[model samples]
Target: MTVYQLPVEVTAFARWLTELAGRLRPDAGWYGVFAARDPEGLRACFDGAEILPWDVVESLLQDAGEPADGPLADRARALYAAAATAHDRRPGGAGALAERRDLMERERRYAESRARELGERLRAATGEAEAAGLENDLAWVRDDHARAAARVTELTTRLARVEGHARAEPVPAAQAEPAAAPARTQTPVRTPAPPAPARPARARPRGARYAWLEESAEERAPVAVPVLPTGGAAPRGARFGGGGDSAEAGGPARVAEAADPAEAARAAANAVYALQRLRAQGRSGEAHVLLCEALNGPPDRLPALAAELHRAGLGADWSTLLWEAASLPPGRLAAVAGVLADAGRAADCDQLLRQGVARPVEELAGACAALHAEAHHREAHALLTAFVRVRAPEDAARLAGADPRGLVPQLLDAARAVSATRERDLLHALRVAGLAGA
Candidate 1:
């Protein structure tokens, strides 16, 4: 059935129930009757009502294409009977208690089934890694099962208490009344209030930059440094020395000023590498600090740093870094796109390339050529076609010369799709110039 039809069916069933209850008992509203909390109150309502059996209710629900059995069916029957009883001003009695027991039983059975499935998976787990992953799932399932079992026990006890209460003999009306009390008076006593405890001194603010200094001695201890395995190249930002920007120029000065520059740089590289490994291992909190440090280090180097993070499987941070470095230089953007494409992020690479097309035609052509060389022909083709379509005819004529894969035929096809115009004439001219079908 379609999604829209299901709600209509449910509404129809509810309306039918309301009308049926009104016909049976006109004084009480359906909701007022069903909303009774106590078994005695509900039983009072059901006293003279002719309630339908569970099977009848189930068949009715099935006819309406709704679930006909289990907790849902029990609850539906309980509500219908309660509404009728409330209208008739009769007791609901044992009906409410019976529905509660059925609901709890169904819940317990579902929980047990879930626990069994999880236990089977846990038993079949092959190694420490697999077992560790399933540990939380198994624990949750077992806990739910235990709670369901405990609830079932509690419900059973309550059901017995309710049954016993129902079977008990009624007290005599005269005996149920309380005896008259004698009048008396007494003076009130005064008491003192307790004093509040004094507040302690406030500590200094510990910012993220110096958070390491606040760590305990054991946490601050030196550890073995990890090197990137053979075939895993360090990201561009990990390089120690560089030229061009002010950050690169000051790198040497910063290193020279440090007592142990080599060690410091090595530590930084190690930290970056470690963060990458931690992210791969799903230790996000530990990696977050290092990610912040890398991001806040140098604006010029952020893109390359982000590219490395992306390669290292820190996708969430990589996306943040990309947004931060959105206005990067054309060359840097192209480089970042290459890194993303190499890391199997073709969509990101294509997006970055589209942004790079806003640069000069020569730069755009070079980027397109690189994209083609990297076997991203589809992206390259789309980028060039969009560039031509948006540019003026004269501008497009100049840009078309740089089209490595002759897109002139595609342009002609586009031209034919539109009404004849100057743009179409320009495309025809370009086609005759051997650039269209090349």
Candidate 2:
């Protein structure tokens, strides 16, 4: 039929499709073309609506009324008979049908296989992120973007090479000159050899006293605290091994040898510092692994040491590991919330915040705002509300009055809500407490 002769409904469908094409994905485009109202679109259609085979039509009828069971089980018996006859007439008809069935089965199997492969890769990547100290959820997203960009670059290069090869004109037999060259008279047309393989990169060597983080903490490094002699005398080092001259000499220490407690503590502290450096560099997973290695066993003051590690940016890893280790008790919620907030795992951070704020009442308003901007509003609200109630009650009250929607507004409102006298008193009390303790 001529273009103008088409029905109005068909014309509208065509225009709707033309507009939709810009937004529709490639996988879904085929179906769109199948239902197009234009002449060109109609020509390109699958034409399978009335071509349902006998078995499919019968199945369709048998499964009718359950639309999701699919059209295969909903067609009439007469439609099946027509399909059966048409299907039987095609070249190698029965064989082709069998082949098609096999192909579909194989495709499904391959799809399942690919899904399993992806799952494995995701799990491994997650482990690597944990190991490498990527405790923050945002870090995972950043890494994912980086990896995807690299893949795109690699694919683009490969495509360029393929296109170059495809467009190159071939030399015809009449123009070819290879056979014309004389074996003895001519220097051999030598082809350049492929480049040699690059040598494997070497790993960094570990020192004898490498400070390790706890596996449970997933910390990048051990916390190191410096200690000076309480006696106010500059001793070269402390004596171990029954506090005798033999211990102070630092010679071949015997089985009964014991390290100076202060020296050991210093070593642990230094290890923690190194771990802090790694965490700053976005290698928290490696830092955590290293920290565990350094400690070698349960240290006496782990929680305090962990707090120090958290200060070093290994907190996110520490919190994640701790929660996993202790059956995720309520007490650890506050710590986990803090770490997750830093790592920018806003969604997970929100969940942890909900669990944490009930007891400790430490609200992560900043975290809530961040996640909210990222479209995790439900979580952000939960976190921000809880945070205001616990850490900044005045601010929370102000927020409650203003009903601020965003991060800064929420923060400001919360601040304004607090009474000036109360704020001054709280600050003074904290300062005095620090002074008295010191």
Candidate 3:
């Protein structure tokens, strides 16, 4: 059933349980009661009223839905303990006398309504097995409630200390005496503090100059040095070898090459290539670590590193890296979409796609097919019109192959001669290969 088809009573009950859970523990709000997946199980969770894994709660609800009989069944019992703990901590009123009265009347009525709902659901379970499962779930909910009680007690004690401190503080006599003073004098206007001096701009560091070189796509800058005559001149592409000692004083002379920004970027990109090679050797985790280090090194080199990663088919990881880059701005979300699209994660790509992305229509058409191949037909249909509007007839037909009926007839109608026949046969082959599952 669709998510909206969930019973109204279930939604209302879940909302109350979620609110109660939130009040008891602030962090619990991150998980909603609907995540539990079972209406009766949620009621049991509310009844027990403590912190519990959302998944376990869902399992209990599943058990409750069928013939309940398992270790997972006693949710109602567990929920009872949680509810008792929550009920104890909730304020009755301003004073103990009022609190007692309110708890007895108002709180009791609310609890009775919620409990009545629970009872009706419990009575509806058909078989002995289902009842047994429900019983087990209730028991687990109780256990969770017991564990949460100690934590709640500690929090209540701390809150009491804070409240006591607030109450014990005495009001200054000067404030009380001011009631008789003139209206203008009641608020003593103090002179405003002078604004602090603006900080001097920081001088750019020397290393920052090298940073541009690391990221630049520019050609090499010329360097002047004395050239030695090695049998008239050195041969083209000849290697020059030297040890570390050669560069020191009184040692062998060192050859100095001109600085090249493009070469440096290429070298840095090559380092990413080395990491990718590691991935090809079944060391993906290590390659990811290395990519992270390279990307983190400097702002300028990051694009080069990202490009290399994309080329290596580490597009998914690269998207995550781009997301984590502090130096990068939010405009990079398009780049993220591109990477996700390339990785065939169309649903994920959809979250980051924005207006004005530089990506063309054909790319999106391909993405539609990828999503369709993944059995996400709804998403594919959403992009189909856009694909036809932008791409060539053949490209659009290929994307439309992902349609429920397949694209053979459409391809045949659009094409001529051998091309149409080839496409028709390809469609049949795709069907035979079971790529289109029944």
Candidate 4:
């Protein structure tokens, strides 16, 4: 419970768990799972993540024989005993539940028989006064019978539901029930519902485009790569549209177009909030596609969409959004990045500045060149400046490994005709990154 106690508990617990797993027979129905898992790997997972491995303990309580005979065996048995006592104390413990069901059945049967006997007595009564007394007694018995029958039915249905669910899936490893539950109640503690199997993560997503996603991959289920929605695949009336006339016509458009952009951004939070839910539900593939389309959509919509997503919170997904945001045109790109910063995504902005993740070197050069040819000096400087400031060494190294891709000339050309004063800071950062001169 205290920080000082954690290290000791985790080490001992992992050993006890492994020992129990190793001792489990094939008949215990848990040998296959333990055999498949590397003991060291399992121990490492426990140590690194402080999650109480209630699922493991529950399985051991259910089917694992016990700790193998050794020094740890005594400690393991003590733990099992404490947990077993708690388990039985819970309102719906295995043994207690059976006993309660039996008691309820007997109560129901007795109530029904008493009601039937009282009814017969009422029917046999001769005098009006006697018949009235007998009828009153019969009515009370009937009510008791009905109440008992209902209670029995409810208990039976609840038990059946719990058993059916237990068969369908094992408890989630993250179920929060402590070894000692906080409260015990008559209402049964329902089993933790297991999630459905997820699609396997794709090999390709761990490459360049999705490299940033790998940082905390161990903390979550492997997210599968998303298949971008095609024209036909797009929801016909999807509230969150990607761009253009269709965006203007969609439900989300009305919200984004509100008189108060801030108010609209707050309201539009649900769009990204839904994406968060999808990922939490292990539908990361869908979440990935939705994010790319929304954040990197039409230039006109980028600021509002970015605001909405930032408002809803991206959890540990800043990299994904910045990757998608990288493809935005220079002006829209800067605007969206600022919105992310203002909405408390300053850390994400820092990542952009450092990594320039998903920065397409050739694409940026061409876009900046087009701006310069049009005599938009400041804008050209802004574009290149943004890229240089986000000095991703990996990207530069990637360029170095294969081809220069006109890096020097691209920087030179972008700097020409630009207002020195207006773009001074950008030029300095660019120079610092060795991509340009003062």
> Could you say which candidate leads in TM-score?
4
**Which of candidates 1 and 3 reaches a greater lDDT?**
1
Tens-digit lDDT string for candidate 4 (258-352): 12555345434645666767655534445555655454322234345555555556533444556445444333344444444445655454444
lDDT by residue (19-85, candidate 3, tens digit) is 5444443223323434344456445545433234333444334533522322122222223223332
TM-score against native, each model:
0.26, 0.19, 0.20, 0.27
Root-mean-square deviation of each candidate, in angstroms?
Answer: 26.5, 30.6, 24.8, 25.1
| Per-prediction tally of clashes | 16, 28, 32, 0
Clashes of 3: 32
Clashes by residue pair, model 4? none
lDDT of 1: 0.43
Worst 10 residues of 1 by lDDT: 250-259
Candidate 4, residue 207: the lDDT equals 25
For 176-263, candidate 2 gives per-residue lDDT tens digits of 4455445544334334348667655444344423432222333222221112112111111111101112224332111112334464
Q: Which whole-number lDDT from 0 to 100 does residue 18 have in model 4?
A: 57
Candidate 4 local Cα displacement, residue 124, angstroms: 55
What does candidate 1 score on TM?
0.26
